[model samples]
Target: MTAPASPGGGSVRPEVALAFAVVGYVALAIFGLGMTSLVTNQEVISVPGLGQLPGIVGMTLSTAAFAGGLWAAVRRPHPSFWGVPGAMLGAFLGYLVGIWGAAVIGGTDLAAATAAMGMLATSWFGLVVLAAALVCAWSGIALVRTRAGRPRWPWERDDE
Candidate 1:
């Protein structure tokens, strides 16, 4: 639950971390699908049973960000920038999971369908996810913590 720190990030209060996690997932869900639709020429986001695709990209990205943020939050270094790599790695892994998941949900071949899953990476979706990760990563760091606790301005804290 604790990572070695070398210029790492501050230990975020649990509530703040939880809040950021919620906001990150929701933000990525919207942004991921928005970017996907924009690039794929879809008027609206795709669904699980849409055609041959599972339409789970948005969900995957959001989940990945959440997982990655958690990882970064708990990392020893706690470096603010750690979220970038953590979330990106999470996204890639999430994509693989999506491939298999789509195969299962769509009743298709996981092996054969793997090659066709390049649309997201090959398109603008990758960039969007990266942006989302950065946003997600900074969520807690931006609070300007004065002490090890919830995000409140210095003036808001009462002397104990």
Candidate 2:
């Protein structure tokens, strides 16, 4: 069957939404990694007094990346459910890239790199992905419901 037209009178295919979401997520992930590195390595890079809270900085960056990705996925006039999976997949890939690149840049050997990844596996990475997926899924559903003239929030009254 043919795809439905968007609210703007243009057709928005699922693939388009997924592609945009993936690109956005990947870019955000890179940005997050850069920010985290800058913050965590302030001493090495001579950015005086900036590496005070690496954990907080990393968490903030991750949250922003997830939110930005979800927003991009849902911003289309007509978004598809595929956007949810797209966001998750993009985030996972981005995390892999960011972590692997960081380890390599830090002069970590293969064993060290494997250890670092293992540490992340038992730490925040999985939690971040799960949270982002849930949020993205909810956001996508809300976008679709809103487009269908339904209220997304509990406080939104259906006057019709």
Model 1 poorest 10 in a row by lDDT? 1-10
Clashing pairs in 1: 3-76, 4-76, 8-77, 8-78, 9-78, 9-79
User: For every model in order, what is the number of clashing pairs?
Assistant: 6, 0
Question: Which tens-of-lDDT digit does each residue in 45-119 have in candidate 2?
Answer: 122222323323334444455555555656666555565665565455445445545555555566655555455
- Say what the RMSD of model 1 is: 6.3
Off by over 4 Å in 2: 1-72, 122-124, 144-160
How do the predictions measure up, each by TM-score?
Answer: 0.59, 0.45
* Model 1, span 45-139: residue lDDT tens: 22233353544653555465556555555443443545456665575556545754665667656544453455555556655655665666555
Off by over 4 Å in 1: 1-12, 39-53, 57-65, 75-80, 110-112, 141-160
Task: Give candidate 1's TM-score.
Answer: 0.59
lDDT of 1 at 103: 59
